[model samples]
Target: MRARTAAERVACPVCGTASVRVHSRYVRRLADSAFRGCPALIDLRVRRFRCAQQDCAQATFAEQVDGLTFRHGRRGAGMQAVLDRVAVMAAGRAGSHLGQVLAAKVSRSTLLRLIRRLKGPERVTPRVLGVDEFAPRKGHIGAETGFCTGQRNR
Candidate 1:
């Protein structure tokens, strides 16, 4: 329900300064996985640390918990994982209905959005290539090779 940053200091993003000076604290409400068919929630209290480097443009920065959540993200890792799988398994409207049936309660547009966020398969050029040969007439004597592209000796 409630949580706080355990780290004494956090590194500044701009100049990489490990700042120990405390600036402020903020509560980030994250939508987590469901508990007993109910949507779970987490109120994470994070701290903002002052930048130690004088030349650093950032005055303060927030501490992040590894594998817990990311900046500006409202959903937790567990919740995101479920939604991602649902989106992949079914298309937008179908997945949305499935989400509601499972008590995940995601909108069709949200499911579509989540699916769109995933990166497509990487395209690569093959180093070696092969082609299949079809049989035009199997019993033909002279036309044995079928139709293949190669050097012909007449």
Candidate 2:
């Protein structure tokens, strides 16, 4: 679909002005469900605009489509969520495999990057986190493990 000036005039939250003018233009890569049991991509043309109000603090703001994130964000929110779940379970390898099958245009590293971005930072207290070796594997020798906290903070 062709992008128009009026269609792009989404209300600017900072100024509450609907009189936005196009400052620049770009293409956004988004994910969509393919008809043949695979995934597909939808390239959305995004526009960056200047808010029409004189007192507005924002010099220029990129247009935001509903149900989307960054203008050219590689994957849509729903597809990103699926990739995230797969990533957490299988880490990079599984996520990359899935992306390939779904035609999501994501690499192993890209999947990892998405996973990292989505997970963000987790707060952890106490000195250490441990894993039991015996209960999970009784016959295994010296399988116990512990991670020293604060390694990341430093």
- Give me the candidate number with maximum TM-score: 1
Per-residue accuracy of model 2 over 79-98 as CA lDDT, tens digit each: 77677776777667777787
| Per-model C-alpha RMSD | 6.1, 9.0
List, residue by residue over 13-99, the lDDT tens digit for candidate 1: 788889899888889998888888887788999988889998788988888888888777788887888889999999589998888
lDDT of each: 0.80, 0.64
Q: How accurate is candidate 2 locally (lDDT)?
A: 0.64
**In model 2, what lDDT does residue 128 have?**
59
lDDT of candidate 2 at residue 72, scale 0 to 100: 52
Per-residue lDDT of 111 in model 1: 84
Q: Worst lDDT window (10 residues) for model 1?
A: 132-141
